[model samples]
Target: MSTLYVEQPWTSMSLLFRPHYRVEVFDEHDTPLMVVRESSGPGLQRPLRHTGFSGWTSFDLDVVAPHGQPIMHIAKQFGRRPHVRVSTPAGQLIGTIKTHGAWKQSLHDPSGQQLCFFTDIGRIDTGARAKRHGKRVRRDRVQINPQVTEPLRSLATACAVAFDVVRGTGTRHTSSGGVDWPV
Candidate 1:
């Protein structure tokens, strides 16, 4: 399958259940698909900003799919979660970005990185588009269901670790002091 790298219009602050974030989706050929943007800010911004905080810790991602599928495809067949390791000077441990719980929801970090779960063929934009003609206005676009998995927590965690190692790197960060702080 061909690889597709869609841009997430939303910011990290919006995905943390803290405030509004926006996202836009495109197909494998750079075709516009969907968009999701928030109309308001998360209430914690002012307070956090005042305290010299930017909300969440730092998490970097390097998606390793060839062209059309996520890297976790094979490992996912065995269990619920899949570990994804990123290659960097400072290696990172990325947990499985899978669907969890009974409802099989999409799981991802604030940056819109595909974690344990993966998306199927469909429009994945969460934004609404509007067209105006004279005094009339029309809304276009639809909500695309993201592919997610519902797996055991333990299995998911293990998959995350394995994913990292599979990529020829073995480093995991468990302490949550934030990346900007001094070591």
Candidate 2:
């Protein structure tokens, strides 16, 4: 997976309001896929996002089809582990993304069993991708347990999108000085 959007410089709209995220998803060859758009009714619209460390920064993102049909729901709950839960639009359990620290993240079953591991750059556990393609590319890709299939793939896709959102984490620079939610 690849992230198709980042911050654009000096847009008038961004100058006036809190920046809204519209994260596009793409394939390895750069083909457009689905989109992970930030919530329309973003909770309270704050300056910080819940990065799993601290603060009340929470977010709801919808992975949608090109025609805008809901695919899956990705949400970040309050925690110190940088977890983003993935579920069906109807709220069926899919999985959770749990970060152990700055260097590693793991995909877990709803029952809390580890499925696979991914580093900040790419897969790291046993069957890790042999080599990384690019920085943003690695950030956009998360190794899914091959055992996972079907609509559940949407959950993995959402996981990749979550990594994209938090790619640079506290390091991204925006005109408005916001970290994760860049304009």
Candidate 3:
């Protein structure tokens, strides 16, 4: 079976957030065609603190297939819901949006392609707790933005990371290696 390889960039967002992952490239038959590897780095346990709160960094990735196209290209969104479009080297009108929160576009793009993606956490507010017997009261509230980095940049970083992974895995260029995501 033929194989292709992609590189893993040390500074990529996926590496910074996930730091470690298992990648396996499969053939059309769902067989393990080539290049399966795992990685870990120093950023795995690093914590980011802000405004008396601590949260983990994350990166979001989206991959979409254009109408009548065999290959799917990655997409970027501007915000959480009612998403906005971002520019790519190929222009922004691919017209693929995710109905559910979990789905994302994935594609193969050469390096230096300008792209944008979104990232943000939902907000919450808490009031207080009180006791009546002796007149005791406690008041507090905490709102957290779980996102540690910009979504657009994070998505870009994700794309770069995926590209690196695909490149590093070195599973491409082989007739046996293919990209397929079942609908």
Candidate 4:
């Protein structure tokens, strides 16, 4: 079983920039795999349309090779639940990432079958009792289907990273900023 790890470098200075992330992916053995970064230039109009002035601003992310060639493209859709679609440079759909809640997200195939699930490790209960006990925590666990092939597996990994970026699950301040509940 091949496992991938995603980490966002935290620089206190990042707070001054226009919301961008520099994410690094590593293998189980701790070797660097690929680098995923927010597109540095001007934001594209089409993708930005879906991301309103709300706390969540949708944008395009690129999975870059060591030599700086973008290998994959991840774009966030404009709507409730905010589906993030992963594709190749040629625009072929690889898979999509969707969140069920602040702590739970899943990756799906084009047909919408779940291929992987990512859960933020923490006390999901937010009741008075749980809050009084100070049980909040932060970490991530990814569970991927064993039957998925290599390329799709890679895309699923990228989906996990994209999920964190769009949702801002890494920082405590913005953890629940994008949540929208039904009436």
My TM-score estimates for the predictions, one after another, are 0.25, 0.60, 0.22, 0.62
C-alpha lDDT score of every prediction, in listed order: 0.29, 0.50, 0.27, 0.53
Ranking by lDDT: 4, 2, 1, 3
TM-score of candidate 2 versus the correct structure, residues matched by position: 0.60
Q: Model 2, 46-165: lDDT tens per residue? A: 444322222224557788876788888887754344677888889887887776654556767788787765542234221111212421212234354455564445544665565533
Model 1: weakest 10-residue lDDT segment is 167-176
User: Which stretches of candidate 3 lie above 4 Å from their native place?
Assistant: 1-25, 30-72, 82-89, 100-183
What tens-digit string does per-residue lDDT give for candidate 1 at 1-183?
A: 323233332223222222222233345555644332322343434343222132231223222323423222212221223332222223333334443432233434424465433333222221233222322111212222333233323223222222222222111111123421111
Report clash pairs, candidate 4: none
Tell me which of candidates 1 and 2 scores higher on lDDT. 2
User: Where in model 1 is the C-alpha error above 4 Å?
Assistant: 8-20, 47-52, 57-183
Which of candidates 2 and 3 is the stronger one according to lDDT? 2
> What does candidate 4's lDDT look like per residue over 67-110, in tens digits?
78778888764345677788887788887777777556676787
Q: Tell how far residue 147 is off in model 2, in angstroms.
A: 8.3
Q: Who wins the TM-score comparison?
A: 4
Error of 1 at 161 (Å): 22
**For candidate 2, what is the lDDT?**
0.50
**Candidate 4, which segments miss by more than 4 Å at Cα?**
15-18, 40-55, 78-80, 113-147, 150-152, 166-183
